[model samples]
Target: MAEDLNIHDADPVEEFLPVYGMVLADPALYHLAVSVGETLDRGDRWAGAIRRQLTHAVAAHLLGTYTRLKPAPETVRGGLAPWQLRRAQDRIRADLAQAIDLRAVSESCGLSVSHFARAFRQSTGIAPHSWLTGERIARAKVMMRRKDRTLADIALACGFADQSHFTRAFAKNQGTTPGRWRRLMEPEARHATMP
Candidate 1:
């Protein structure tokens, strides 16, 4: 039907059928019928227009049948409940400086690792590992404000194994090296202290 009617995303038919009953409640058909009458009165290309409208009118029914025939995909299990999500986030935040075990994390939520991972992604719109990394980066940014701390110290404190690992992760997350980010923050820090 799409090929027959030349329906494109930019120029597509909008569904005007809201009611479902024994008869099709097609407001689109009514609108098109009115348009055809108006075009006929003006002596325009009413024939061609009516043909296109008829194609859409037929295609709508065909698509409705297609929808009815197609089997729906089985949805994954429900997302972590709100309390479960909060508990997971708290656990992640508390253990941000330590190595995370997926099994352990999932167990805390009373779920299998696969289910927990899927539900975590569903709740947060990010994979668990990615969310963890982002949290680690956020922690690093807060520690970065202190000029006394070395990058190596900050790295280990924020759950990264080494300075190089920290640098790569921080660069990817912040779009700059940690040292550069610190340097940029210095002026802002200095200004904040003044009256």
Candidate 2:
């Protein structure tokens, strides 16, 4: 069966079932199968429900195996789907003032935390936390343009814990403290407003 499916030793499948070819190729379906397997292994109270889901997934996999030999061009191989990426970005941007919950974001995209993190990094060329930090810094820069907003306000708004935490992160990324950056931007802001 494995030889027919072209699956090798390195493939993620443990049992080498014929239907696994289609299921493993599809990330969402693969995740569901793995989750169901784990739940069954743990002997969940809802074992019957989980087993029914597993049956359905296996049936779908088998149907797909016979029906679709060619892989979809848009199918996720290593990275997130466009819609998943957009959803994650939107979720992250929706509440920059609050601490980012990676698990929540991953769940929102119907992915496990580890898989989502890997796919996200593969797609964006950076880890999710790094991306979030970059976004916070970008937002802080924009907020700094306004003289009325204090550094503490910018920090909190950008999801930093406090002024000191924000200062450390800002300096690490920008090579200057938040206060200095603000001071540096003051001239630019003044020059722009003057004309």
Candidate 3:
């Protein structure tokens, strides 16, 4: 359908159909669509004016999709009984800096420690200590990206015992040292335009 339209011919009408189709297909085009529309409209081309309108219309459609895709906060309302586990998870997440007792977490869920340990593992696919470690590691990754903090500070903040512990844990989960991981995360000059 696109080739039959000979959109590459650059006739305003020909350009309109394919460009309009693209706008309809992927409306999250950042500013590219708007800029194209403005540039075309400024040229005083009839097709350009039509394109601007079509672009805006398509943009509106994409906006709706984008808003819908905004990830909703995980909620416990109207869900399975186990959804209350979210509260327990949230509590644990909040105090990631402190030592979490599996017994206490189970009590929060109103389950016996042993039962909760098993069920929580079944629900989340990992033991509570493992899950807690993963969450702390994830938080540490975020901290490592900023220039202000030292590795020692990040380890302390994320509740690890010390630098050696943090390094070993980070290596186990990420398969690389923290320094190397941070280096890899740095942008190459050629890809500077990326988000």
Q: Which candidate is the best by TM-score?
A: 1
Among all candidates shown, the one with the greatest lDDT? 2
Candidate 2 colliding pairs, count: 0
Off by over 4 Å in 1: 1-77, 188-195
Q: Give per-residue CA lDDT, model 1, range 1-195, as digits (tens).
A: 654432321112321212222466567667756765655655457676776776676566555542222221223368887678778877888888887688888899999999999998876666888878877977787788777789999999999989999999988876679888777766656567989
Candidates ranked, most accurate by lDDT first: 2, 1, 3
Candidate 3 at residue 81, lDDT?
Answer: 43
TM-scores of all candidate predictions against the true structure: 0.56, 0.55, 0.55
- Candidate 3's displacement at residue 164, Å, is 0.8
lDDT of 2 by residue, 87-109 (tens): 99789878887767899999999
lDDT of every predicted structure (CA atoms): 0.70, 0.71, 0.63
The residue-by-residue lDDT of candidate 3 on 92-181, one tens digit each, is 788878888777777777777777777766655567787788778778877886879999999999999998899999898767788877
Report the number of clashing residue pairs per model.
0, 0, 0
- Alpha-carbon shift of residue 146 in model 2 (angstroms): 0.3
Cα shift from native, residue 104, model 2 (Å): 2.4
lDDT of model 2, residue 183: 69
Worst 10 residues of 3 by lDDT: 12-21
